[model samples]
Target: MAGLVWKDIIYIKKMWKTMLFAVLFFILFSFSRNDAVSSMALIAIMVGSNFSMIPFNYDNYSKWNEYQYAFPISRKTAVCSRYLFGVIVFGCCALIYALIMMFQLFIINEIPEKEDLLLQIGVVCFVPVMQSILFPLIYHCGVEQARLYFVAIFALIAMLVIGCSSVIVNMFCEENTIMIIAAMIIIPILLYIFSLRLSINIEQKKMA
Candidate 1:
C-alpha cells in the first residue's frame, strides 16, 4: 500500500519545478491585488483544485492501471493510494498558502478579516471535497470523459448556488450554523467512503 502511494508521489515529485513556478506566480499575483489576503485564499483553493487530479491523467497516459493489476495489490489499496495522494497534494498546497498567509500577516503586517480566515480554512479542505466528488466519476468513466462530467456538475452546482445565494446565506444563519457545519463535515466523509468503495468495485470489474 505504501509502495503504491509512493509511486504516485514520485509522479508529483517530477512536477515540482513547474508547481514551484505556479506557486510563485500565484503569490506574486495575490500580493499585487487590492485584497491580497482574499486573493491568496482563492489562489490556494485554485491550486488545490487543479493539481489534485493530476495522478489520474498520469496513470491514464502511462496505462498504469492495466499494468498495476499484475502486482499483488488489491483494488482497494490502489484506490486508497490515489485518495492518499490527493490528501498529500492538498497538504502541500495548503502549507504553501499558510506560509504565504503568515508572511503577509506577521512579516508584512497585513491583517485579514474573519471571512478571509474562513476562506483559508475552506481552501485547506477544497481538494479532498473535490476528490470525493471526482474519484467515483473518474474511476467509472475514465479521465477524459470524467473531466467533462465534472465540469458540468460543477457548473450546475455553481449556477444553483448563484441563483440561490440569498437562500443559502439564510440557511446558514446563527441558529443553523452548527447544523450546517456538521453536514459539511459528515457529507464529505460519507461521500469519500462511497467513492472509495465504488472505485474499488469498478476496478475489480473493469477487466474481470
Candidate 2:
C-alpha cells in the first residue's frame, strides 16, 4: 500500500496543475462565511474539477492499464488504484481547505465546530460519488475524450443538483441526520461498485 500511495504522490508531483487548482479552490472557499458553506464549495470542486482526470488519461497513454493487466497484480488492485487516486485528490483539497480554515480561525479568533464537521462530511461524501463517474468515463474513452464527456456530464449533474437542492432539502432537511449520512455513504458505495463493474467490463473488451 505504501508503494501504491507513493505512485499516487509521484503522479501528483509530476502533475502540479491539478494540485494547484485544488489549492486555489481551497483558498476560494476560505472566504466563505462558515465552514459548512466553505466545505460544500470545496466538495463542489472535488466533484467537478477534473484536473486529475487528465493525468489519469496520461497514465494510460503508455498503455499502463494494458500493461497492468499483463502483470501479476489482480485487476481489483488496478481498479482500486484509480479509485484511490480520486480519494487522494479529494484529500488534498480537503486538507488544504482545513488549513485555510485553521488560519482563518486563528486570524478571526472564532471556532465553528459544527460547521467544520459538516463540511468534512461533505468532502468525504462527495469524492466517492465523483470517482464513480470519472473512472468509468476514463476507462471507456481514455482521458481526452473522457474529459469532454466529463465536462458535459459534470455540468448536467451540477444543474441537476442545483435544481434538486430545494427538493432534497425540503424532503430530508428535517429528517434524521443519521439517515442522511447513511444514504450519503451507502449510495455512493453502491454506485462505485456499479461503476467498477462497468469499467472492468470495458477494460476486458479492450484486452480481447
Measured by lDDT, the strongest candidate is 1
* TM-score, one value per model: 0.80, 0.73
**Across residues 47-102, which tens digit of lDDT does each residue of candidate 2 receive?**
43564474475566756655655657666566666666666766665566567667
Query: Which prediction has the highest TM-score against the true structure?
Result: 1
Q: Write the per-residue lDDT of candidate 1 for residues 55-138, one digit (tens) a residue.
A: 888989998878887889878788888888877877787688788779878998988654445445544555567777788888
Model 2 TM-score?
0.73
Q: What local distance difference test score does each model get? A: 0.72, 0.64
Error of 1 at 154 (Å): 4.3
Model 1, runs deviating above 4 Å: 35-42, 154-187
RMSD of each: 3.2, 3.8
What's the C-alpha lDDT at position 31 in model 1? 77
Give the per-residue Cα lDDT of candidate 2 at 95: 69
